[model samples]
Target chain A: MEITPTRVNFEFNPHVPIIMDSGIFKAIKSGGSSREQAIKSMYEDNKFRTQLSKYIAQNQGNEEDTKDIFQEALIILDKNLRNGKVDEDQNINAYLFKTCKLLWLNSLRKNNKIQLIDFEENPEELVTNEDLETFREEGKYKSLQKALTKLNDRCREILVLWSQSYSMKEIMKKLDLKSEAMARKSKHQCLLKLMQIIKSDPNGWED
Target chain B: MNESFYTELLEIKAQGKLNPEQEALLTSLIPQGSDLSSELKAYHLAKQAIEIDISNELKFKFNEWDQKKKSRLFRVDFKTISIAASLFLFLSVCSILWHSNQHFSNRRIVNDHLHKFNTEIRGVNSGPETLSDRIGKLRDGLEQNPTLVIQETQALLKLSVTGVQKDAIEWTLALAYLENNQNEKALTLLKSINANPDHSYQKHSKAVLDKLNSNWRVFLF
Candidate 1:
């Protein structure tokens, strides 16, 4: 059976378990191999793919655009989950769809390519306060990426792992640290250096 | 709250392992409306942006798409092809050879200027260690490594030196740059020398510029 966007049934297939109902969020929060596995499953899921394709088709978007928006939405969702911003009662699939749709609309409005009818039929302003928040988030993400390039390769790697919520034991093993303490110290130092660099740059945190 | 407290709170928040009591304490200490809370959220977002890796499936798909695009762009049907492409390719090769010959012929004039500068006139040695010795070394170095001579001459120009000494170094550097196939840099230095009325090498620079401006073989044959 071809999976439709609204088809919530995943119990028939014992091979690929469903990532609905906060399961994927919990996997991502757990970090390490679990997060990687969760992301891979999401990407390869037929239902998820169909949902993305359906959403993109409605908005005059292509496969490439759909893939990019889906990936970005996942990252934002994961960030929100980690920051305790996501409501516990929210449905993951619906949340992902809505966020991805808004992101695409924001992108269209940003490039001024949205047709007059598209805007008129919607009636509400496309450039809402939420779009402004997304814009600010994207801007900060860009600045953070730029600042990351300024760091040493080793420091950057350590911080990346640390940011993903890797345990000190895992970090020690990965980086060949002498002990968990060494990993902790290195992570702290690298994180501090990154924060200092970002804070010093006015663009990273605008007044 | 202090910056350190906020930093630690952000680190803990990013880890997503805060217990209920710890979470309650954090919420009580730093309210949702506080800038510190906003900063923490921003840090978490930045961390997420950095840590998240794209899936291998996406990467493989991108590679597949790229290869398909490249093949589509370069695909040609031999039976239905025109001879214009072959003719264009042949003409392009001939044009490139002609341009390379023109470049080499122009380089010969610069070589001649170096030969004349080394043999006919002597560099002023009024400064520290005799300018003639340095020029001789640079000339010999040029024979082996023109790029090295260019760098050495540029360094010498940075030194605090007299009028005659500076002009001598600048002129040599211009020649070195020309020999290095950097015609624009050579033209710039030569123009500066020619523009300076007090420069001892003004006449020689103007003469070189005139020849360079005229034709590739103006000074030769």
Candidate 2:
């Protein structure tokens, strides 16, 4: 089998715009410490957290609410960025704030909590309806992930490496498989087993 | 295609290693609304779920960081803080200017390539409304009505298509995505085309990708 060598680069240039759907973003997709570093920077950035805390507070939320909403916003942002839903030039801070606002509003509406303040912001400025729809779709993945945890350790390891773009040769070496073909077959079986597990659960994939 | 062939294709796809020809073959072989297609969708969902799993791990790490940060004590001198603030301001200004220039240049380069692609499509669009002609029209319609073009191209992909026809349609669809400012989708399609040695649009796709990568490298370094 002719295996293309995987490109491995450890250098993370802090100057590159991490929001751009290229370059560093591609590095993040390929998965490594760079992705972790980028997420850490976003998490630790006080400006975004401070702005969101103030917004949530003004809208009748407490400190715990601010932290929870902020964390959810970060997840949404990270998912959108990975899925290419975010545009290159879009303001990340504004996007996160808008997502938090929308999520909080949905939560309040669900709880039948009386509105403390009028959120008269332009609807267009909020995250797109498509983004909300995508977020809904993501809820299914959480269930699927529950199914994933049921897989045996070796199967889980194989599937994770495959998803991370590891080459068959590397997987073969790491797993002590006889050949690349065996590695490929192992990944295929693991995926099929995961699918079977998901299918077996009556409530596994319920939307 | 036979059952084994379909299974092989699905396996390759599950590995995320399907070349363009194999992708087209799988599309042609799988019956619409069949169990096979659902299985393929399951595989896709599983892959996405794994990615979400990875992100969740990161979220766990973030929680750890939050706890650790809360527990840590910080002490800073005013002079040190002042010097750091000054340096940050200077670097921020420089970074803003550099990023603006890079963004502008990258946009210009992308526009130039799209213009070239438009011309090429027009040259191929003279015939009647076959698969290629429909793709050509979709490319032409991208500027005037991108949403319609995107819808039409997506619908077109559902129909059974030959390998070369699939390549033409996908290339045009990628361009339409670019026109619609969906860079991620466009990049995915372009990379697929460039990876497949037998893909009809391989050369053009490579050229565009090369330009894009060069610009990214310039921005990175």
**Judged by lDDT, which candidate is best?**
2
Chain A of candidate 2 compared with the true chain A, TM-score: 0.66
Please list all clashing residue pairs in model 2, or write none if there are none: none
**DockQ of model 2 vs. true complex:** 0.18
Candidate 1: segments with Cα more than 4 A from true spot: A1-21, A87-89, A115-143, A202-206, B1-6, B10-221
lDDT of 1 by residue, B37-98 (tens): 56575565456335432222235544565576557656644423546678788899889767
Isolated chain A: TM-score per model?
0.73, 0.66
Kindly list the per-residue Cα lDDT of model 2 for residues B35-109, writing each as its tens digit: 665777666666666666665776688789987786553333556777899999999988986875655443444
- The per-prediction CA RMSD against the true structure, in angstroms, equals 26.0, 38.8
- Whose DockQ is greatest here? 2
> Native contacts recovered by candidate 1, as a share?
0.15
Fnat of model 2, as a fraction: 0.38
Q: Report, to 2 decimal places, the DockQ of model 1.
A: 0.10
Best by TM-score: 2
lDDT, residue A33, candidate 1: 77
Tell me what fraction of the real C-alpha contacts between chains A and B each candidate also makes.
0.15, 0.38
